[model samples]
Target: MKIAFVINQTHKEKAGFTTTLLAYSALQRGHSVYYIGLADFVYLDHDKIAAHARIIRQIGNIADTQQLIDALKSTSKERVFMDDFDVLWLRFDPVLDMINRPWAAAMGLQFAQLAQKLGVRVLNDPRALVDAENKLYLENFPEEIRPRTIVTRSYDDVKQFFEEQHHEIILKPLKGSGGKNVFLVNKQESKNLKQIVEVICRDGYLIAQEYLPKAQYGDIRFFLLNGKPLIRNGKYASVHRVQSTGEIRSNIHQGAKAQKAVISPEMLQMVEKVAEKLIQDGMYFVGLDIIDDKIMEINVFSPGALLQASELNGEDYAAAIIEDLEKSNGKNKTE
Candidate 1:
């Protein structure tokens, strides 16, 4: 299988990232793997989609993800046609480029959509990704699993939601990740409410959600593939991230510690609630952030933590994902 991973940038990727693991796993399986940055794509005349991709060469000699990262950085990018790839995996964080290269993520998606139309499999369906680009996408799911939330660029709207939620609310960029600019506000600390809203809205809109008290204990980062729990050897691919002292964000990169997740019946039920829509949207891979009984976020674009989940659960989730893709593509060919 020839798979191309579209990421924010090759230089910005780390060895511990889920994208690295997937690419390394594909290489270990003797499949061709390529890394494409958001700005790497080129559109030729006659509707051909191509990219100057960093091809992971000599996969046999590369030992692990660090080596893969090194190769990706050291190797010069070579032009490759997108249609030649068996899978064009959109693994980039849209918010990463939203500031400096506002056009990068959208252009990447546009190229992915073109690639999909040309019969190349694109994961997480580009069309769906367009609408799912921001936190508002969570509204598309059943309200039962989501927290009381409001999206606005107005400080007054945020203030209203804060008052409605009894002066406790979580505010963050409507389109963001990695816990950047996330703020937890309460009645006693409402002094900075207006300022926070102003800062967050500078980029775009801000999401104000009823603060779940359970968030003090951190949240679960659960992995789902094809809208189902990614399980291996009776263990689900998930990690319970414990936030640092006095911190509200449980993002792994935001000083959160990863531990084995204790999957509950209620969590599985929540999965069932969102699974159908995810499958229908062609979100082949996703990550859900759960606090208590409500889902705080649905990460369709580059839902990470698979590596940490694998380490904690003693599972090979990357291999499982690659194997599933291989089988699915094989079945498609046979059909």
Candidate 2:
């Protein structure tokens, strides 16, 4: 199978990232893998979409993901046509480049959308991704499964929402990931509410959500592939992230520990509620941040921690994803 991962930058990826694991798994399976940076795309005169991709052909046994990362970094890039690949995985985070290279992610998605139109399968459907670019995407799901929230750049709106939620609310950048700029503001911190809103809104809009008391215990990072739980050997590919003491954000990169997730019937029910829409939207791979019954976020763009989940569950979740991709490619070929 020919698969190209569109990432923020080839040099910026880490061995621990889910993208690296998936790429390594594909290489281990003897498939062609390429890494395309967000700024590497080109549009030729004949409507051809190409990229100066970092190619990592399947070679001798790759010992680990670190080795793959080493090879990817050392290897020189070559122009590759996007349509020739079976899958063009959009794995770049928009917020990462929102400041300096604000045009990078948008241009990458535009190319991905064009590639999809030109018959190359694009994951997470770029058309839907345009709308799902921020926290507002969660509002598209059933209201019962989401926290009471308001998105605004107005300090008055945030202040009003905080007061409505009993002076307790979660403030975050509407388009951010990895818990950057996430804050748990309570009554005691009400004095700084305006400043917090101003900081978060500088990037774009800010999402002020009713603070879930259960968030004190952290949240679950649930993985879903093709709108269903990714499972292997009777274990689901999910992780329970426990934040450090006094911390409110449960993102793994934010001093949170990844433990084996305890999936409940209620969690599965929540999955069912959002499954149809996700499948319809072509969000082939997804991560949901759940706290109790309400989903704090839906991660469709570059969700991390699959490696941690696999390590905690003692399963090869990356292999499962690659195998699924192979099957999907085969099915598409037959169709």
Candidate 3:
């Protein structure tokens, strides 16, 4: 089967990340792959989607890592239609370069939907993704599984929220990732809260919620594939991400350490309730941020954790993810 990954940019990726591993695994399975970037996709007449893709033939017997990457990058670019592939994985992290081209941020979801309409299987179905666009989507979870929250741009709205909570609050842009512009507001920083709100809210909505006191330890990030735990050798694809000592954000991109984690019952419950909906909505792969068992965020587009989770569990999680993709796509195409 031919598999193509629609990404933001190839040069932006680093070694030991989930996206790279998945693409490599696909090649190891003898499947052809095309790595397409944001500008690669072309919308033709009648909504046909296409891109110039680098067709990676196979992973040679080279043991050295860097050379293997060189071989992967050496493929010639070819214009491949989205309908030609059995699966089109939207592995690009839009938030990474969203500020650069705001319009291109939605291209993955938009084209994924188009490709699906043409009978190609896409991860995290585009329809579900459109609904999961912002942090406010977290509120759709069971109330018991989410932290007390308020979404508003009104100054009075934020003040009343802080007054009611009367504790440290975690404020961030409603539509954001990698913990960009996230803030921890307390009595000492109360005055700055308004400024923070002014900045983030100007671009979009703001999220001001009761900070989970337990976040100091770290947050547990769990990966749910096809609405089930992708556990192998008794290890689930998950990890505890500890923030940089005094920092409130635990996103690994912001200097967080990944460690083994215990999947609490609350975490499992939340994943189960949300995963089915995600899969039903065409989300094959996803990640959920759990702090004190409250669902903080649900990453539908390019939900990455395979690398860190695989590192902690002593198994390559990308292999598991790609295997699942093959199985699901095979089943769908056969049916």
RMSD to native, candidate 2: 1.9
TM-score of each candidate structure, all chains considered together: 0.97, 0.97, 0.92
Clashing pairs in 1: none
Error of 3 at 206 (Å): 1.2
lDDT of 1 by residue, 1-335 (tens): 78899999988999999999998988887787899999899989546889999886448678889988988899999999888888999999999888889999999999999999899999989999999999999999999999999888988888888889998999999899999999999977799999988899888889999988888888999989999999999999999999999888898888999988899998899889999999999999999999889998999989889989999988899999988998888833211
Q: Who is ahead in TM-score, 1 or 3?
A: 1
**What TM-score quantifies how close candidate 2 is to the native fold?**
0.97
Candidate 1 residue 4 Cα shift, in angstroms, is 0.4
lDDT of 2 by residue, 1-335 (tens): 88899999988999999999999888878888899999899999456889999987774656998888998999999999888888899999999899999999889889998898789999879999999998899999999999999988999888888888998999999889878999989989989988888888788888889999999998998999999999999898999999999889888888998888899998999889999999999999999999999998999998889999999989999999998998877833111
Query: In candidate 3, which residue ranges exceed 4 Å CA deviation?
Result: 61-69, 72-74, 331-335
* lDDT (CA) per prediction: 0.90, 0.90, 0.77
Per-candidate clash tally: 0, 0, 4
In lDDT terms, how accurate is model 3? 0.77
Worst 10 residues of 3 by lDDT: 326-335
